[model samples]
Target: MSLTEDAIEKIIGKFGRYQTWILVLICVGRIPTEMQLSNVVFIIPSVNYVCLDEGAFNATNYCPCKYPEYDTSTIVSSVTSTWNLICDRNQLASLAQSMLQVGILAGSLFYGHVSDRYGRKIAVLLSLLSEVVFVAISAVVPEFWIFMVCRFLIGTAVGGTMLCCYVMIIEISGKSFRPYLPGLIELPYSISYASLAVIAYFLRDWRHLQLATSLPWLFVLFYYWLIPESPRWLITTGKRQQAIDLLTYIAKKNNRPTENIESLVIKIEEQSLKENEQRYGTYLDLFKTSKIRVYTLIMALVWMCCSHTFFGINQYIGRLQGNLYLNVILSALILIPGLILVVIGSLYLKRKLSVIISFSVAAISLLVFIIIPSNMENATLAFAFIGQLGAYTSFVQVYLYCSEIFPTMVRNSAMGFASVFARFGGFIAPFVVNIGIEWASITIFSALAFCAALLCLMLPETKDTVLLNTVAQTEKNKVVVNQEST
Candidate 1:
C-alpha cells in the first residue's frame, strides 16, 4: 500500500458504515440527473402528424401533408404534438436532446473549476439547486427555444452535480472500496433510467412527465445539511482545521479511536504542506510529453465515440418498432449486466484489454444488425440490445480508464476537455439520426466504435497500478520503468 493509503487506513479504516452512508448520499444525488437525461425518451414520442398545407402535397389518388398537424387522439401528447415540431420542424426534437449535451460540456468545465477553487459541497448544492429551477422552468416554457435553453441550463447544472459529488465521494472513500464504488454508483443511474419508462407511461403528457422528473430534484437541495465538504480537498486547500474536524467525525462514526487522530492530522498536514511546494500542472501539460499526448488524443476520440453512439441509440428510440415504454425500459435493463461486467473487469482483468474487448463486442453486435434480414425483427432487436449492453459497458470502462490515466492536478481539466469532445459527438448525433437513412447512421456509429477499440490497444493497462500525483512524477516513473525493463 502507498503512504496515502496506509494513512487513510489509520484515519478511517477500510469501508465502513460512514463510507457507505456517504456513498448512498452520493448515489441519491445522481438519481435526478439520470431521470432528466432519460425523460426525453417520453417527451419526444412520435405522433400522428400531417402537413399544415394539405394542398402542398396533392397526388391523383391521395395527398400526404408536408407539415402534418398531429392526430393527437391516436397517440400520446409530446413535444412534437404540443409545438407542431413534426415534418419540417421535426429536427427540433433532436435539437432539444442535443442541447443538453452542449450544456453539459460547458457546465462540466465551469463547475469542475468551481469545485476546485471553492469546495465540493458548495458546487454540488448550487448545481442541484440550479438543476431544480431549470427543470421546473422547462416544464412550463412557452416556446421551443425557451425549452431548449432551459434544457441547456439543466444540463449544465447536472454536470456540476455529477462531477462535484462523484469526485468528492471517491476522494472520501477508502482505497479498498474504490474499485467497487464506480460500478455501484452507476446502479442508481440505471435504476433511475428504467423508472423513466414507468413514469412516462403513466404521465403521457410531455409537461406532466417533465414536472414529475423535475420536481423530485427539489428534494435534493437538502443535501447541504446531510453531506459534508470533502476532507481530502480541505487538506489540499490548506484548510487544516476543517479537514481534521471532518476526518475526526468520520473516524468517530466508523467506531474508530480518536485518541490517535492528532498524529494522523499532523501527518496529513505535513504531507499537504510538502505537496503544496510543487508546481501544479495545467491541461496543456497533458500534451507536453509525446506519450501522454498520444494517450490523450486517443482517449478523447474514445469518449467522443461513446457519447455519440450512446446518445444516437437513445434518441432513436422512437424509431424502434414496438411499444416506446417497453423499448426504453428494456434498453436500460440491458445495460445492467454490462455495468456488472465492468466492475468485474476492472477488479480482475487489465483495464485496456477489458475496454478493447467490450468496444469490439459492441461494434460487432451493432454492425451485424445491418445484415440481419428485415423479416427477422426479433433477431435484430436481440442484437441491438446486445450492442447496447456492450456500448454502455465500454462507456463505463472509458470513464474509469480516463480517471486513472491523468494525474491529480489536471485530471478534471483533461476530463472536461474530453467531455467537450463527447458533447461534440452528441451535438452531431441528432443530425446523424436525421440523415434520412438509418443504415448510414448505424454504419457511422459502428465505424466509430471500431476505431475506439483500435485506440484502446495503444493505452497502457492501469489496473492495480499506483496513481501518479503529478506530471513530473508520472514522467519520472515512466523513465524508471523503461530503464528497469531494459
Candidate 2:
C-alpha cells in the first residue's frame, strides 16, 4: 500500500494544537533523564583512571586532598590479593564503559525502528527495564568478559531510551510544547553533570558507584504508570479508539472537553485505515531519499566534527597539560551559558543562523587557542574555557536543529544515521590528538577547526517556518546553508 500526503497532513494537523500554552503546561512530561546521568558519572572515573594508573602520580600532590584513599589507591589490588578473583586492568576498565557506546552505535537503528513499529511506551519500558538488569549485573560481574557484555547490554538500553523518550514526548505532547520539551532534555545537562560530581564524591569506588547509579533505573518503573502511550503513534497504528480516549483524557485533565470525540475517532479511523497500511522502510530509508541523503550527510559531518573535537580536546588537556577535574569543572561550567544561548537563539533568533555562528565561532576560538601564545596558566585556562563554550553551544544548537528538521516518521532514524560519523569521530579523536600534536598543540586544534569549518558548509538554515512538513517540502529547501557567511 502506498502512503499518501493526505495521511501525513492529517498527522501534522492532529499535532497542530499541541503547540498551545495550556497544553504545554499540562504535558510537561519528563523521562528518566537523571538516572542515565548517574550511570554516565559512574562510568567516568574508569574513563579517567589512566590519570592515576599504577600509582604513578601521588594523589595528595596534584589533588591536595590530604588523604591517601581519596585516590585510585592500589586498593583494587589490595583487596584482590586476598582473593583469587581480580578486577581487570586499566585498559579493560576503560574499554568496559566504552564498549557500551560501541553497543549504542550498533543497536540504535534497530531500537529506533522497533519503537516506530510497535509503540513508544512499550519500547521505553522494555529499554529501561533491560538497562536496569544489565547495568546491575555489570556491577556484580565476576568475569571481565561478562562485565563488558553487561555493559554493552546497558548501551543497547541507552540507545532504545534516547530514541523512545524523544519520540514519546514529541508524539504525545501538544504541538505548542514539542520544541520546549525537547530542549529541556538537553539543557539540563549542567544539572546532571553537577549531580554526577556530587554523587561520585560520596561514592568513590567504581563498583559501588555503578550500583548506586543503576539503582535509580528501578524508579523508571514509575514511567509505566505516568507516561502516556504516544497518541500520534496510536493514530499511526490505526488504534483510533485508543487515540481518541487518550486525547479526551488529556482534554479533561486540562479542563477542556472534547464534544465530538466519538465522531472524530470514527472519522479519523476511517480516513487513516486505508492510508497507514504502508510499512515504514528500514532505518536505511534515512539515506534512500535524495533530500534525506543531503540532510543526513551534512548532519553527519557536524556530528563528526563536534564529537571528534570535544573528545580530542579532553584527551589533549588530560595528557598535555592542565588539571583533570579543573578542566572538567570548567567545561561543565561553560555548559550553563551555552545552554542559555541555545534556548535564546533557538527560540528568538534564526536556528540556522545560530548553527553557523556557533560552529564558526567554535572554529575561530579554537584557532585562537592554537595560534596565541599562552605563557600564563590563567590564559590557557581562559582560552580553553572560551573555546569549550563555543564548541558546546554549537553542539547543542546542532542537536536542536536536527530534532526540528527531520520528518516525524524518520526523525530518530535520521538522527541515528549520523551515528556512524559521531562514532568515527570518537574513534579517531584521541589518535588524531596523539599524532597531530607531536609538532605542536596548534596543529592538533587546527585539525578540529578545519573540520568545523568544512562541516558548516553542508548544513541548511532552519530558522523560520515549520521544518520538513512533507517530502517535497524537505527536498525543496535542502540547498546547503554556508556556515562561513550566513
lDDT of each residue in 104-180, candidate 1, tens digit only: 88888888677766777888888878887888888898988888899899889877776677767666765556567
What RMSD value applies to candidate 1? 3.2
- Cα lDDT of candidate 2 equals 0.56
> Tens digit of lDDT per residue, candidate 2, span 229-288?
766566656677788888777666555557766665565455444433433434766776
User: Please, what is the whole-model Cα lDDT of each candidate in the order they appear?
Assistant: 0.74, 0.56
Clashing pairs in 2: 18-174, 18-175, 18-176, 19-175, 19-176
Give per-residue lDDT, candidate 1, residue 424: 86
Error of 2 at 11 (Å): 12
lDDT, model 1: 0.74
Candidates' TM-scores? 0.90, 0.75
Q: Tell me the spans in candidate 2 whose CA falls farther than 4 Å from its real position.
A: 1-97, 174-179, 260-279, 314-327, 372-375, 430-459, 464-486
RMSD of 2: 6.7
Candidate 1 segments whose C-alpha is farther than 4 A from its true place: 1-6, 56-67, 73-75, 259-262, 265-295, 466-468, 479-486
